[model samples]
Target: MGQLFESVVMAVKAIFQNKTRAFLTMLGIIIGILSVSLMGTAISGIDQVFEKSIESMGQDVLYVEKFPWFMMNDDWWEYRNRPNIEEEYAQQILDRSSTIAFASPSSSRRADVKYGTQAVEAVEINGTTWQEAFITSVKLESGRFFSELEDRYGTRVAVIGYDIKKNLFPDEDPLGNYIMINGNKFRVIGVIAEQGKFLGLMSMDNIVTVPLKAMKSVFGRLRRISISVRPKEGYTVDQAKEELTFIMRGLRKLKPREADNFAINQQEAFRQQFSNIRFAISAVGLGITALSLIVGGIGIMNIMFVSVRERTKEIGIRKAVGAKKSIILFQFLSEAIIISLIGGIIGILITVALVGVVQKFFVAQLSFSLVLISLSVAVLTGIISGIVPANQAARLNPIDAIRYE
Candidate 1:
């Protein structure tokens, strides 16, 4: 332990004697560690944002549509030609399936909404059944969701989103107030709780919802619709999906050999797609980071070689005084490791500061695992870079190195 401590002290002294060269040697390592840590933070932030967006869509809900969310076999035309899913299927599923707790058909269109003089343009207007409240995790900030009777009788009651309420009814309570959608007058019955951005791109709070019947009356029923279904409390998702598929196949009247035309999608589908994207991003990011680390390692190796050459006479004198080769090797190797560790610490500090700045635009997280990973990479790089130079120094002949002018 004492010998190791002495070697470390010698390494520090050597490094301090040539502070400028040591700093230059550490520069590459600093940049490499910074790049890797920042990349990790960005990926973690993206994942968190995606998870929040997915949570808005209930985990237990399944979406039944004419086309699948992900392309299968590059067959775009095949899905495009599929028949449009209709609102009637939602009722059929509810009536026929025992495993389904709730089912609702939903469709969307972009339109301008107005209350008196205040107007919000290009707002998403969703047409869905009252059961949609059960199928999704929609919470109300104020007022109440539309009743089943209103949905059945095609009442002109509407539920507004957070942004709509903010823009249209800045001061006054939105409940009991009539809003104009396109040209028709609809009473606002509820206001959805604030839901931030979806995938950090589109605002989830900029939407308005009304009864399916009312939407069809206003916008026509030719547009495609999707059914949202939730499994009963006692049943699993797979069981619900199985029951739903059987009923759908029966409703569509597919023959024994004929394939079903509809698609059943779940929250996992979105998670899988996001996971693939994240994996790709990680691969590319790590690849680039590896390149930077490689360059940094090469720099360290080159500098170590120059250091060994300059200290040849010093090494010879130490050997003549009976200094072991292992001690000499440890001394140089310790210097390299210490330099890398310093760079790693600086890089981590910079990353923490940058993460705070990045959080203003998007969520960026830095965890202890990332800190350990950066430091480990630095240590490994130092060891690998110092091996050849340390070996050369240890193997130098005492007489020849002492005589070197």
Candidate 2:
């Protein structure tokens, strides 16, 4: 322990004596650590962002659609050939499925929504029943959702999203105010609370929802419609999916051997698709980043060799003064380690500052585990770099080394 402490002290002195050279030698290590840490932080941030987006879509809900969310080697034409998903399937699912809580039939179209010329272009106008509010996550910032009577009568009542509220009526209360769509005036009955982006890409807040009956009146009933079903409490998503499959099969009158036409999709699909995406990203990112560490290690080795040559006479002096070969070996090893470790620290600090600046816009968190890993790798790099030069120094003949001017 004493010898190690003494070696560290000597290493510190040596580092301070040639500060500029030491920093230049450590530059590679700094860059390497920066690359590695940045990659880890970026991947972690993406994971967090994905989780939030999926949560917004409602974890318990299953989407019954003609096409699957992810298309993996499956033919799009095959899916297209499958029968269209029916709006009546929602009530049928509710009646027949034991695992289902409630099912809401929903359909959408892109339209320009105007509130006295403050228009939002291409905003998604969703049409669903009053039970739609019960089947999914729909927290209101203002008024209540439309009642069953309102939906049944095709009342021109609408619920708007936060972005629509902001763009259309920034300063006024939107509740009971009339918004025009296709020259038809619909009263705003509720405003949905601000839900952040979907998958960090599209806004969840650019929407206007009305009763399905009212939508059929304006847009007609020819477009695609899908059901969003949630599982009953105490039942797993797998059980709900199984029940949905059976019900759909029975309803469609598929034989024991006939393949079902509809896709039973959930958040797990996103998880699966993202797993592949994450794997691809890590494979490419880590491969490129690892090269930096290797180059840094090589640079450390070359500098340590030069350092050993410069301090040859000092090694001889120490040997003549009763210093053991192990002490001489540990001294250079400690110096090399300190250099790389300091470089790693600097790199980490810079990464932390950079991530902090951008985290508000996106996700970029520097975890403690990543910090430890970077430091550990830096120390390991120093050990590997120092050993050869350290061994050469330890084996030097005292008289020969001292005389080699």
Candidate 3:
């Protein structure tokens, strides 16, 4: 153990003595390890962000809509030709399906909400029943959500999103306060909990939800609804979907051979789609990160070869003093390993800090668990890069090595 410690100390001194060369040699390992570490951290962060967003919208809930939520691409004309699905159909399907526990129809429109002289423009106005809030796992931060009685009565009451509440009523209570939408005056019934935005598109905190019946009265001729469904405790989601399909098919009067008019949005389906995207992103990151490591390894190899040439006389003198070839090999190998290990530590620190900075925008946090992986790869790279040169130095004839200039 003492001898090993002495060898490591000597390697450290040699590195400091040739500081510029040592740093130049370490640059490749540093960059390679850093790239891979950063990539792993970044990918992990993105996955967490996606999971949090999905979780915010209840994991057990599924949707039944006319159009697919995540289609690759569809023609505008095709969308125009699509028939409008009715809310009554969703209720009929829910009533008929034994596997389903509860279901509700949801619709959305863009509207400007005005509070006194202030106006929040282009806020998404959602039309849903009281059950919709429970299905979406939406919790009221203040006041109360619209009751079934309110929906049945078509009351002109609205639930404001957290951001909307903040913007419109910074100090005062939003509940019972009237907000004007176009010419309609609606009383704020509740303020939703602050939820973060998703994919840089929509702000989850900036939406307003009102009763479906009241929305239909104001907007007129409501066509489609975003239906949320929950499966019964004993039944799997697939069974619920199957039963739902049968009910919808019968309701639409479609023949067994004909294609169904509606689409089912399952949570598992979103998970699968997101998983595919995550895998693709991981593959690309790994590929790029691997290239960096490979380049660094090559750099280490080149420097090691030069190091062997420069230390030829030292090896000869050691061999003459009864030092074995293994000692000479170990010395050079240890030096390379030290450089890589130090670089790996630095890389990890930087990568972690970067990931932290990126997570600030989201309500959720990012996590990394690739420290062991980075260290292993770093040490392995160092040993592999040093092998050829270490072997060459060890095999050198002492007599010839001593005589060489």
Candidate 4:
């Protein structure tokens, strides 16, 4: 312990002797740490956003659609030719499938909405049954979702999204107010809660929903629709999917040898797709980090060699005065570590400051684990880069080194 302390003191003195050189040597480490840490922060932010978006999407729900969310074979044209998912399949799934607890058929179209003089354009108008409220995780900010009776009656009542409420009824209570959609007067019954953005690209809250009956008349029954399905409380997604598939195949009247022309989409499939995205981002980050750290490590190694040469006479003098070879090695190693660690600390501080600005635009998170990772990498780089130069310094003969000057 005492020897290590003395070595650290020696290292500090040597660093101060040429402060500019020490700082310059630390530059590589600083940049390396900064690049890697920022990459981690960006990845973490993406993960956070993904998790939140997934939660809003409901973890257990399934979508019966004409096309899969991810086409494994890149055969999109094959799937495009498949028939549209019928809206009535939602009821069939609920009635025939033991695994299904709730099902809601929904369709969407972009249209303009107006409340008196205020207007919002390109708003998504959703048409679904009352059961949709049970399958989705979206919460109502005010009033309540339309009831089964309202859906049966094809009432003109609509539930507006948070953004629409803000845009069209900025000063007044949106409830009980009438909004014009496709030149049709619809009364606002509820406001969907704010759901932020979906995948950070589109706003989930920019929507208006009405009953499927009304939706057919407003958007036309000619358009195809998808059905949302939720599994029974204790049923696995696979079990639910199997039941759904069986019913859909039967409903489509597919012959024993004929392939069914439908897609069953679930959160798990979405997760797999997102995992691929994460892997892609990680690969890029790893490449950048590897390059930066390697350059930084090389820089440190070169500087340590120069340092060993400059301190040879001093090493010999200390050895002559009873300094062990281990002490000399420790001294150089500690110096490298300190420089690298200081650089890492500076990088972390920089990351912390930038995290706030990043969140304002998108999402960036600086976590404690990420800091630990940066520091560990910095320290590891120091140790690896310093070892050979430190060993060379330790192996020098006192008589030869003293005579070198």
What is the TM-score of each predicted model, taking all chains together?
0.91, 0.91, 0.91, 0.94
lDDT for predicted candidate 2 compared with the true structure: 0.88
Top lDDT hit: 1
The sequence of per-residue lDDT tens digits that candidate 4 reaches over residues 16-59 is 89889888888878888888899899889899888988899888
Q: How would you encode candidate 2's per-residue C-alpha lDDT over 327-393 as one tens digit per residue?
A: 9999998888999899899889989998998787787899999999989988998898888888888
Candidate 1 displacement at residue 139 in angstroms: 1.4
Tens digit of lDDT per residue, candidate 1, span 1-405?
Answer: 788899899989998998899888888888889988988988988989999999999988999998888877778788888888977888888899899999899999999999999999999999998999988998999888888999999899999999999999999999999999989999999999999998877899999999989998888864769899999999999999999999999998989898878899998899899989989888887887788778888888898899999999999998898878999899889888888888788889999999999888787899899999999999999999988898899999999998877
Query: How many clashes (backbone N, Cα, C below 3 Å) per candidate?
Result: 0, 0, 0, 0
Query: Whole-model lDDT, candidate 1?
Result: 0.90
lDDT (0 to 1) per candidate: 0.90, 0.88, 0.80, 0.89
Error of 1 at 146 (Å): 0.5
Instruction: Give the poorly placed runs of model 1, Cα more than 4 Å off.
Output: 1-28, 321-323
Q: Name the candidate, 2 or 3, with the larger lDDT value.
A: 2
Model 1 CA RMSD to the hidden true structure, in angstroms:
2.4
lDDT of 3 by residue, 1-405 (tens): 676676788778878898888777777777777777776776666676677678777867778787776765654446446566778876797778898887888899888999998899988889988788767777889889899999999899999999899899989988999998766889999999988766433679889999999888888866577788888788987888888888878887899898866778876777888888878877887787687777778887888888889988888887888768887888888888887787787777776676677666633232445888888899999898878888898898999887767
Give model 1's TM-score versus the native structure: 0.91
Ranking by lDDT: 1, 4, 2, 3
Candidate 2 — worst ten consecutive residues by lDDT sum?
A: 284-293
Root-mean-square deviation (CA) per prediction:
2.4, 2.5, 2.5, 2.0
